[model samples]
Target: MTANRFTFRRLDLQDMAQASRIHRAAFDNSLPWLKGLHTPQEDQWFYENCVFEQCEVWAAFSPDMAGIIAFKTGWIEQLYILPDFQGHGIGSALLRQAQTTFPHLQLWTFQRNIQAQQFYEKHGFIAIGKTDGSGNEEKEPDMLYEWRRAGS
Candidate 1:
């Protein structure tokens, strides 16, 4: 499908269910350590209250919601797309939108998620730090990536 098929927009409270579904599905599928970590209901509740509350969220919709990217201050808190929509430009679209909005942005990705690392790197993000599974709930090794505007 062409990029024209997708619409990007800021999301609100009404979009909670759809956005949470993408978030839960993407993480649950990609992260081995996250399997069974939380019930679907628990995840939804957390997404709405914790994740949604903390960030400004934008979604890419292929008539229906296909993906979302959420960020706050200088941090990209979340980005997720449905598995069926993975290979398309939905993720790139969302990240481009986020990058345009935040001249400098940073995010954390699990060390095991190589696809994510590669994607971010392709978009000009560079690893700035690494952790030994101490600060996050998942208790897994993670890396921090940062993107800054040229000459900034």
Candidate 2:
């Protein structure tokens, strides 16, 4: 699908590197305190082995990867937009792939990311639960957000 200058497509193995770059850049940008939490190799490995192998990965490319989302039947593992792509609809377009596919969806966002919290809230996702700085590699407190389609 195409929207504006962006086109959406299933992420292929060749996209592992770009997807990892977007995830790491956005993750560190949104959580500066957790910057460099993983090396480039680790990020690439995770994207290759975990995300690509597990989820239905997709991306929005304005001739280049502007955003990416990794999602399964009921969970969104990752959603990131390149810094330059923020404020555009790339994130929302990638998110809609999941929201439109499943009747419901859930994902985690760090508690400190107010912008991310607001973005999800604006898109009809509600904070369904929370956790302390545990159970995660970053040990950052996070909230679980859920979205259910209207009448679903």
Candidate 3:
């Protein structure tokens, strides 16, 4: 899709379910090893209770919900684009939206997700730290990334 084609806006309660679906699809596609780790119900609950309650969620819609970014303060909790929409600038647009909101941001992605690593790095997020699988529920190694506005 063209970069200007997508509509970006804040998410509402009615959107939590679709956001959960997008997260599951993108997460499983990127990290197949973790597929089925969470039930659809659990994902929905997380979105409604944790994500919606804690962060501000914004989504991209190229006629449909294409991607979402959940962020708060100096951290980005989630950013997922539908697999069908991957690599089409939707993700970058959402990420840039988040960057524009916060002067600094931090997020974590599984170590094995090379595409995500490269994507974040390209957007100026640097690897600040890493950890073995033990620290997270998935028990998978992860890399911590941070991005800050120039002179901030």
Error of 3 at 6 (Å): 1.0
lDDT per residue as tens, model 1, 43-124: 7787789878998899988899988999987999999988888878888888888788889999999999999999999999
1 versus 3: better lDDT goes to? 3
Question: What's the TM for model 2?
Answer: 0.96
Please count the clashing residue pairs in each candidate, in the order shown.
Answer: 0, 0, 0
- Report every candidate's CA lDDT: 0.88, 0.91, 0.93
Worst 10 residues of 3 by lDDT: 1-10
Candidate 2: residue 125 Cα off by (Å)? 0.3
Candidate achieving higher TM-score, 1 or 3: 3
CA RMSD, predictions in order = 1.3, 1.8, 0.7
lDDT of 1 at 133: 84
Task: Give per-model TM-scores.
Answer: 0.94, 0.96, 0.98
Question: Tens digit of lDDT per residue, candidate 2, span 61-140?
Answer: 88888889999999999999988889888888889999989999999999999999999999999999999968998899
